[model samples]
Target: MDQHAQRHGARAARSHGTVEPEHGATTAARHPELAPGTSGMKGRARHIPATVSLPIITALAFGCFIIFRTHTAGIKGGPAMLYGLAGAVVSGALGLVVAHFQSTLITETRASAYGALFGCSLGWVYSLGGEAILKSCAFGFTMGAVMFVAALYVFRTHRTREPHGLHRPHKTHHRDDRSHRLPAATH
Candidate 1:
């Protein structure tokens, strides 16, 4: 028999009764903890520095903006620096708290939390430029609403129905049924 026919026959034979494993079966068998749907890294915590990095960076940027705004408003060097440093520390703490709880929140609440954070930060910066408290709050509320709506839109548009990178096509068996056969021609 030709090599192709030999290979096809072998495949058919294997499919008929052989107990060959599907893809990733061996690896999954070796690690029961990583069984089909589970992530292998259960009970492991993420690195602390990596987790805090984004919040720190955001705090630093917020502080720098506050410092610049304070200075432009004719605040003296020491007070401007103090204001900036204080704002940085507060923002950093707030950011860390938000980051910690963000994962546990539902999508809408998480988005609103982020929006509130952003709005508060912006309003604080605005106030540092000598704006009145009422005006600053109104501005912050408006900005927060905008952020919340934008976040909802983005999340809705970009969300996937299934987990990323975890799709597996189902295996289907073919049968040699009479419905699949061609009809005989009449003489």
Candidate 2:
């Protein structure tokens, strides 16, 4: 019976892609890079330098603003160019600041900052679309509040999730039903 149980255990471990060696070290312990969360850490921490990130951010902002000015605002020529340039400059500056502060700030705080920026940008665009100052203010405030709450919730939820790729044993519950057994009938 013991040998049968041992064989079953070994088979289960083999099926699970894990083996308990005699030395009692897990495969992941021997190769930390193969371990759950640590695998991505080294690769993920490779930061984009500010020079490259800024230009990419600026280009994207410029393209978006040019599209907005031409399609939505019906602007053309020098004015559109200037607006696009302005957007590029603003986004570049914002990107630099974000990059600088990213390492220092908590995830929730960074999320809030991004949310507030989005709300402010939306409010500015709304005002440009002929809305009154008070209405724009109210809209921006509402959006900012919503964003703050959403960001907080998202960061909290994301932080609580376990990192994947770890092998964990599943637990099973066993119940004894001896008390509920019926008496054997005589043939």
Candidate 3:
């Protein structure tokens, strides 16, 4: 439990070789000087948070702002803000439903395209005013497919390059084999 043991990543033993609690912390790594985040290339990208979800928050906040703005405009009945609220709520719902399959921006764009298609189908249904089976499926399908394809194409072609700043020379264990060999043969 002393600082030497902590810096050296040494483990105390119970009856078995199982590591003691003191050594189980991250400081016990072989290279104990390296912090968890900066240890290597693998460590950095593993911890990005859900900052991408802020758009949903913005949509809902804008919806609320619109409702207040409309209310102040002498609206006594159904306000124009309901459309904003509907857009915000529906888009958020769609995002939530689709996010399960989307692990990155590229995949999320495809999901958003799907949501757009769904929303258009809903709009087509609404245009019929509660009638049965008259959606503009062709238009929605074409648009959604086009968008998804375009997004994927861009992601594939314009992919970001690997960072060069962190590059390191390849590691090798080869040593002078001649020094370990027998003496030269004498005729």
Which candidate's TM-score is highest? 1
All candidates in order of TM-score, best leading: 1, 2, 3
Better of 1 and 2 by TM-score: 1
TM-score of each: 0.57, 0.47, 0.34
- What C-alpha lDDT do the candidate models reach, one value each? 0.75, 0.62, 0.53
Any runs in candidate 3 off by more than 4 Å, and if so which?
1-51, 57-79, 104-136, 158-187
Candidate with the larger lDDT of 2 and 3: 2
On lDDT, the leading prediction is: 1
How displaced is residue 77 in candidate 3, in Å?
6.2
Candidate 1 residues 17-83, lDDT tens each?
4433442235546655556776656413233464487999889998888889999999979999999
Please rank every candidate by lDDT, starting with the best. Answer: 1, 2, 3
Candidate 3 lDDT, 1-187, residue by residue in tens: 6698668878666565556656454453544336655666555445444434544674576456545554555443464456557756765665555544444334446446655745463444333332344454655555666666775565455445312221233655456656556798999
The clash tally of candidate 1 reads 0
Native-to-model Cα distance after best TM-score fit, residue 183 in candidate 2, in Å: 61
The TM-score of predicted model 2 comes to 0.47
| Residue runs of model 2 more than 4 Å from their true location after superposition | 1-55, 58-71, 160-187
Local accuracy of candidate 2 as per-residue lDDT tens digits, 82-111 = 666666666666756755675556766766
